[model samples]
Target: MNASDSPRPSALDWLVEAARVRDAEGLHRTLAPRRADDGVLNLASNDYLGLSTDPRVIAGAIEAVQTWGAGATASRLVTGTTALHAALERELAEFLGTASALVFSSGYLANVGVITALMGRGDLIVSDGGAHASLIDGCRLSRARVVVVDRGDHEAVRTALRERTEDRAMVVTDSVYSIDGAVAPVAELYAAAREHGALIVVDEAHALGVRGRGGRGVVDELGLSGAVDLIVTAVLSKSFGSQGGLVAGPTTLRDHLVDRARSFIFDTGLAPAAVGAARAALGVLRAEPDLCDRVRENARRLATACGAETPSAAVVSLIIGEPAAALEVARRCLADGVAVGCFRPPSVPPGTSRIRLTVRADLGAKELDRVAAVVTRARTAVAATDAVRR
Candidate 1:
């Protein structure tokens, strides 16, 4: 057949087939943006301290916009280094008791940049099986010999580090596992890394606002902020109620990242408004240290309601087994005025679909009681339906 005689191959046919497959698997996703002034009790968000809407944070953002305009005009190495950015970095370093900090556009870039900058083809990277996607991507992009140990396996980490053929090695993990809310054995991991003379990177994205005194984070809680081989990374969007990511560690590390981290070197600096709001949130966290306690208390309460283990951070996850069932539970909760998070494959492993419930400091006890009731009813109903099907 001639080229023009045969049917034309549609360039987008694969996407349509992929969508059909996803739909059949009950994995099709759609955006559902919350309306302003919506009365839904949001248990799905990462704003643990509820500072996203705080007047001070809003004001800080506005002031920054008025002063520095809407966006950062350039990358950090160029003209984007504003005084606000410097102040935020200094304040973050002080708050976390780190020698210095380098801010990135987002936590994902921070992970990618840090890994690829410090590690290369000749180096070794020991990662946790449960590390965040950003960290996983960083490991892949670093072109290093990567070995993933089981989550929180210090001995395995040590073994990997010791067995490394490269002269340099790094161990990376999340301080708190995001999905299950399991806290990593960071202290033990750090000890193991030290014994093997390897550097350790702890992604404190989930723990920064809920763990340690005044929300200093797990590293600070464990008194490892001063450890020469330790690096702590956190996102500003969660407890900080802003947007951006930061790497806090020795000044030498910050200097190295600034020079070698391509993500930092190429990406525009975080917006002035985000930087300002993050600074304000830090102030709020320092002033109201009990916000941390309040969030964890709420998490524990939610955990009890869902029959999940108490979380070390602000996340309370209920494993619902199947994606459709988990989605049903989330929908029921939302219909009852409580919006919880639903996680399926790719976000979590297959067959481990779950409902992720996050707590906020500003949530009242009465509100929490209502949330607990709604979640319990939804879960029970889903379980009953599943049993009947079985």
Candidate 2:
């Protein structure tokens, strides 16, 4: 073979150059093993209601393992689904006040299913500019013409809907923006969707167990309930302290998804332990509705101490602006026996890198003070670093 015919290095070598660029920009990521017994206070997790380790939640999971074995052992369409799954779906739908609900192995899959099943060629999708990665990917999978509007901009959403030539359209968004922790304008979006005759699909992954009456969700808080034509999706891993995803919508939608949604049709059923845990969590949420207020209160405490206004939910974003500054702040907090989420692009927009603190309802007054102080110190350190650099 001629020298020119030989491959120029290899595609694998390109990864090394990419890594160097990421390292230079402070955009590289590494996974650190979490030591449960370590004395680090956690503000990085999505366990908003602090039920993940609750005695009842643990017991429910254990009992399910005994009853249904370990793994699902098959797909839901086969023999994977158990009575536990059915019960959880029914209870979740009823508790959320929806016509019906369907379960998925992960919230990500549920999102993909929603888009793939509902919108194909000749359909349209209006998405939020800052929607979660899952929703973004889901839209990409659809054959629909997708339009992204500014975050929570109902006018833009409506404009896109108005301009669509397709008769069937779906408006997709996250009820709560994960990075900034800002709640979406669900009511306004609903109105636009209704006016445009578009179906609404909202991923309540961050809202389901943290908003509304007993964490019923933003739709319930807005009293959309059965009155609005909508679809809601959530992850059980977060607020529910379990692992799985669900879709709550009309009975017909559930039926269609069951047959047409590739993710749901092929993926293994959600594990029995997750089903049981979510069921118990839902019951606990209903009985102890005050947990919702507690989480919000904790978030406000952290936000106020960070010099930011009170946040509506458990997440409080302390924007660092620069990627290096955000990483430095996160490292400082971790060194001080606290763990906080460090968000950088492409998770968030460039120049908006920040530490995202997710407050737990169980955090005591003293714990909250400690978290506040640590965050303040990290932020101050970032300021000092900038001053010295300048």
Candidate 3:
């Protein structure tokens, strides 16, 4: 028989089935690119500080491109490390009050690199159930025995640590949950890990530009910055308005990661433009500490508009319960010239699909009022439709 006529399954059949399943479950996703002047009131992006289009940030990127070109030409171990990278690292460490810092091309790489380098086979990893996907992926890749405790369950974390059979263990969590914007019990978790001789890794992706003093992040806010057992992974993309990630901790840890973290050794360094942009954003954060306060206040107002609890950070989540309903609400808001995040299964758990709203420091009161009106109308319309269907 000819190969094309054989009855064997095509290699792509599984992917087609997967797509069908996603569509059936209302989980199919597609990219929606925004035009430069879409005029949409964007409350969906993670630009908490609103520095992405700041003049200083733009100039920094331009300067970097002019000086270092468009990309980090090679892997860091070869020739990608530039002066901008070094300066950004030093400044990040200083801002976070850590001894040293290591930069990666992305936050996912930073989390995976640090976790896999620190914990290996036979080691234990106690992770928060709601930790970011990067942290979860890192735990899976570590080849360590993993225990996922309920979010904010400090007691469970302690129990896992106490019951651990592995000699070396690490506890992982996000400082601010990406879905509901809940702040982790960082201090309690830190104490538990310290008492149990376990290292703690905190991903501060959402907390950096919105929480803590001058946006130093939750670890610094909680006074755990230089704790010997603490390590921090942060994304520059969200808070810094750039494209990169960092691992900040002890100099010893930095040294070890440089030697042992495969992601660092093999991945190209962050482009000079990102490094410069992040640095400029950091400077803006420091210069205008009020940006932190402004963002949280804006988030509080947004949450109040939707009747959600006030957020500890810049994200305000309104649970919509069903993926289709959540998508419908988001669609209605977009149609009204407001953009919002519609988070469904996998991004959130079943029955907790939600409209996730992020606030920027520069969001004006008038814009927020409009957002409140649009979101309220959307929710009301969806509910009315649901009631009729029922």
Candidate 4:
């Protein structure tokens, strides 16, 4: 081997360096899969309505699998469009009060498709600083000039909208932030966008089955259904307990995305089983509206017991400051037979490491008490470790 080849580092060396940095900073994360037979108290999952394991939902999935087999088999533009896909789109549109709706394989793909298809070079996108990473990546792909405004600053959004040079502009934000569970001022934001002739896009990933009357999401909650200009996108993975995404909007916009959105046009359509499961979940939501309230109450109880502020939605994150401490707290809770989420930098905004907890309608009072006790012990342990270091 040549001397240069022996001394020089490979491209994979950069990955090793990154891993080393993460290890030193306590930012490294790994997945620990739970066995199907293992029984543990779960406050970590996004199944807010607890529909993933519901009998009706499972039955629907089974039926679909029996009829349609496994995969969609092709892209929707080609041979993948099925009757189930059409039915799900129609039902979602009717439920959300939109003129039309289109489904994507995942929420991430839906965001990428919408942003890239609607906006282009010379277009302007005014996004909230707290918008999810998918939205941020979509902006990058759109080749639009992205102006990130302060979180929930309506007046600042208005000013930016008014000052935009591009004839095409869009305002994007989440209805409920996934990390802190804070509700966005959607009514004010949409009004500002309308005044400036800009389209508004709201991602209701966390709000779909957790907000509004009958869980129709923020638009329905605010009674701004057809009045909002552009569209709404959401994940089926959360409260819907399925694996897909959908964009609800005017028929013209839906058609535009169908034709131009690379994510939709190129990617395989959602599985038939997922479509069926989501439809079943929607039916369940219609029959039992109080499930939403129960999830909200569970969230309130946990936050109250922890002496933390009650989250505005189903996600209640206890901000633990430092990353190492947050991880330690999560570990202790796991050891205590409680499974909770630990979110650190990159997943959350810088300096806001937290143990993010999602409340489920299925969690009873006894379960809540156990969770509270474990969290209390975890918090005390973290505090004592910090005191020792000082």
lDDT of 2 by residue, 1-390 (tens): 999998798769889989999999999999899887999999999999999999998899999999999989899999988999999999988988888999999999999998899998899999998788888888899878889899999999999999889989989988888987899999999999999999998888999878988888888899987666798998998999899888998899999999999999899999888888988888788889989889998999888888986788789988898899999999999999899999999898899999999999989999999999998998898899899999
Instruction: List, residue by residue over 147-232, the lDDT tens digit for candidate 3.
Output: 99999899999999999888999999999999888899999999999999999999999999888888888988988888889999
Q: Model 4 over residues 301-375: C-alpha lDDT tens digits?
A: 999988889888898889898899899999999998989999999887667899988899889999998999999
Per-residue lDDT of candidate 1, residues 62-178 (tens digit): 999999999999999999999999999999999899999999999999999999999999999999988999999999999999999988888999889888789999999999999
Q: 3, model 2: CA deviation in Å?
A: 6.1
- State TM-scores per candidate: 0.97, 0.97, 0.98, 0.98
**Which residue segments of model 1 deviate by more than 4 Å?**
5-7
lDDT, each prediction: 0.92, 0.90, 0.93, 0.91
Model 3 clash pairs are none
Worst 10 residues of 2 by lDDT: 224-233
**Model 4 whole-model lDDT (C-alpha atoms):** 0.91
Instruction: Give the clash count for each candidate.
Output: 0, 0, 0, 0
